[model samples]
Target: MTATLQPVLSADAMVRDAAGRAFDDLAADWFRSEATFPDDAARVRKRQALLNAVAALGFADALASPDAREAWVDAASILRAQARSAAPIDMALLLATGDRLASIAGDPSLYECAADAGLPGNAQAVLALALGRCLQICAALEAALDLSLQYVQDRRQFGRPLARFQAIQHSLAIAAEELAASTALTDLALACMVREGCASARLPGLLDAAALVLGHAIDVVYDASHQAHGAIGFTREYPLHRHSLNLLRWRDDLQRLRGGELRCAERLGDAALQAQGVWSAVTALMQPGDRHD
Candidate 1:
């Protein structure tokens, strides 16, 4: 869109409406320019332009202090904007949300400070957690969208494109589950974040839990979408490559850090006690030199 993240909607408006418009405008510009990048340098320039715009909008400053609920809402707008604009920008914004949450985790003053400033700390925590989860899951949605678009354009098994097949419908149905699950969890987390509760203390734990589930669910969506798309789905020109790469990056980097398949399995069954115990042990075992691979 533009190089400044302006508040198109007034603060007097409901948060939902305000949040919706912020991203809608940027996304409009984003998708309009999708695939318009002529080269790698162009892509970098475009992403930098968007980041400067978002930062100018004061997007990342949400963590400047303990009381920043409005900033969080706006921060989310920047994220949605970058998600449609550029992959690296989107990944950076999403991962940054986690860093902000981690920053929240150690600040004990957040509760009273938030209350004094008309921001709800517990709810903010939930929103923060959901923000990170949503960003990570965006990789899955990207993968599904990429593969679905490519396959619908090119695969022909019978007398027509694979998109016309009943089996293709089944595949979409399965992949959509991942999309829906992540979206639903995000909504729940946001709701909890807005409501004041003791849940704040448990946010880090909740985030770890959601990260595990979303991480694994994304893989399912990626594999199924590619299968439905067939051989063309594997091609380099396939638009799926961009999204698939992002998914791979997220899975390998962020998801794996919290523990990937093993964490997912534990959360899938008897999550309450197992997650708590596992986090306790993992926290104890963590060292300065630890590495994922």
Candidate 2:
């Protein structure tokens, strides 16, 4: 498919306005302590603050939107802004509220059906969570890559900056490629979801592909960036560790919570076999009339 996404285009512009500016401003003012990284307790407090800020921006109502496509777009854009800013908040909780919030927070008794409920039976809500988390991972990887590049340029070894070395350049290039691939997969998945609605049979497989791609990206980015910065990058004193640690945690949490046994690859393989080929599967998935059962 084409890289041009209409929702992404409009959402990008929309996120850059007041809502986006407010998020950025709050991030700067609230999490700008470079002297020390916040502890888990502190992070929890900050997350609540962020939840409030997001609600004030009217993003909390997105999951309730009657228009499934619009809800997904709004949630994705809001999460994108948060992740790109490297804010210390739980990206998963951004789309959760009320009973959904309770369920996502581990209080399953409050809403056992939440995972399978909402506009169009919460299929879009689940997609929004995955989509938001994917966007956040992409942002974290991008931040790590940027920090590594800057570190390599400034920190010298062997009579020159590390970035001058071809080996370092090669590593960073690989990191960049991984980031790009993960991002493209996410956009493609979003396009499929928007075009077919969250009820399409192909939605699960597309999101699985995105999750798998992002999972690989976390490893590649973590390795490349840490190798570039050496021991200094892992230290809490630097901002690199924040993105790196979050990437690791989020990857694991997403897999464990949503993927279970890493069956995404297997499921996708079965899908291709069922469709007779990868090309046929993809083409059929994008067809206009396959939105529902």
Model 1: worst 10 consecutive residues (lDDT sum): 284-293
Model 1, 1-293: lDDT tens digits are: 67797532332335534555676575566646655655453344345444333332333234434354335545544454444333432334334445554222222122223234443333433335234435545634754666585767576766798777777777777777777776555444333333322234433444455566567667777788778766766765555655565455444433443445566456544444664675554443222122111
Please write out the lDDT profile of model 2 over residues 1-293, one tens digit for every residue: 46664453244656535555765665565555432655544344344434433332234244434355555555555556666565543434433433454323422211122232332244445554555567668878888999999999999898999999999999999999999998787776666555566555666776777778889989999999999999998665777876876676556544543454278778777878999999987676555454532
Clashes of 1: 1
List lDDT for all candidates, in order. Answer: 0.49, 0.63
State the displacement of the C-alpha of residue 10, model 1, in Å, after optimal TM-score superposition.
16
Alpha-carbon runs more than 4 Å astray in model 2: 1-14, 21-68, 88-123, 286-293
In model 2, the clashing pairs are none
Residue 273 accuracy (lDDT) in model 1: 64
Worst 10 residues of 2 by lDDT: 106-115
